[model samples]
Target: MRNRLKSNEGQNRRKKRTSDVEPVFGHIKSNRNFKRFTHKGIKKAELEFGLHALAHNLRKKVS
Candidate 1:
């Protein structure tokens, strides 16, 4: 048996990502560009979500 955060386990988890999200909410509120989705339907929303995630990743890579 093993404990959590032991032997660098927790450190590994901390090294992983998070936060392709926090700024989006702020952007939506502060910038009208992201506020309100004119797009409709679950399928369309899902596609947009995927695209946003992909774009976020690409941006992170470039930066």
Candidate 2:
């Protein structure tokens, strides 16, 4: 694991992956105040996350 992280290709991939998704989650957690879900069941939790993801996508469209 340490050697892979130290490799040039691995470092590039890691930077690209984190840059792509980190901001979206940071925005969701900070701006949307989505620290935790209120729903209990698996189905409800899925629905809740789906809604939140949809909202995030819609915001992207508007901006």
Candidate 3:
């Protein structure tokens, strides 16, 4: 892991990856109260998650 972090390509990838995802998760956990999914199966779960994300974005837009 240390060696991987040392390379230029790896460093850039790491920076890009870290910037990409953390905030959405933090908001979902803290603001949305999204702890677990209620639906079962792939389609239902995907729909539920999409709705949650849409709600989160709408809240962001409104506030």
Candidate 4:
């Protein structure tokens, strides 16, 4: 894994992956203080996360 990331192609891929995905998680965890799921079951957990993602998208769109 270290060697792969050391290559040029892997470097570009890692950069793209982090740029696209990491900020949203960082914002959700740090800014929103969302650390864990309050619900217990899988269905409820999915719904909760879906709602959070929806709200994030809506907020991003509005701003």
Candidate 5:
């Protein structure tokens, strides 16, 4: 929808990868804001991703 990210092309053309990132992303989607992070910048994006990863790892270890 946004001009910055092409929808049909991005969703279909991007190469899918197997990694822990997918499961972590699934858990993070419990929050609506996370479904589409509005931040603008590599540092901010990295921080948000790192926080999600940290939460996921902690939950996995405790459970």
Candidate 6:
């Protein structure tokens, strides 16, 4: 894993990955205050997260 991260391709991928994903999670956790799922079952949790993702995308689109 360390060796992979040290390579050029891996470094580019890591940069792309963080840019693509980290901010959405940071916004969701910090701004939205979504710490944990309120639903219990796996399916319900997935549904709840799906809603959150949808809301995030919609907000991004609006802005």
TM for candidate 5 is 0.50
lDDT of 3 by residue, 1-63 (tens): 898889998999988877977788788878778898898999998999899889988888999
What's the best-to-worst order under lDDT?
6, 4, 2, 3, 5, 1
User: For model 6, which pairs clash?
Assistant: none
Shift in Å, residue 32, candidate 5: 8.5
Model 3 CA lDDT for position 18: 78
Model 5, residue 10: distance off in Å is 21
Query: In model 5, which regions exceed 4 Å deviation?
Result: 1-21, 30-33
Candidate 6 off by > 4 Å? 1-6
RMSD of each: 6.0, 2.2, 2.8, 2.2, 7.2, 1.6
Using TM-score as the yardstick, the better of models 2 and 5 is 2
lDDT of each: 0.62, 0.91, 0.87, 0.92, 0.66, 0.95
Q: Using Cα atoms with residue i matched to residue i, what is each candidate's TM-score against the true structure?
A: 0.46, 0.71, 0.69, 0.74, 0.50, 0.78
Residue-level lDDT of model 5, residues 1-63, one tens digit each, is 464246765644443432435655666787434676567899998888788778767887999
| Residue-by-residue lDDT tens digits, candidate 2, 1-63 | 989988998899899989998888788889999998898999998899889889999999999
Q: TM-score winner among the candidates?
A: 6
lDDT score, candidate 3, position 35 = 90
User: Which sections of candidate 4 miss by over 4 Å?
Assistant: 1-12
**Collision count of model 5:** 0
User: Lowest-scoring 10 consecutive residues by lDDT in candidate 2?
Assistant: 21-30
Q: Assess the local accuracy of residue 46 in candidate 1 as a C-alpha lDDT between 0 and 100.
A: 76
lDDT of 5: 0.66
**lDDT of model 5, residue 10:** 60
Distance from true location, Cα of 36 in model 5, Å: 1.6
Write one digit per residue (lDDT tens) for candidate 6, span 24-55. 98999899999999989999999999999999
Note the clash tally of each candidate.
0, 0, 0, 0, 0, 0
Off by over 4 Å in 3: 1-10
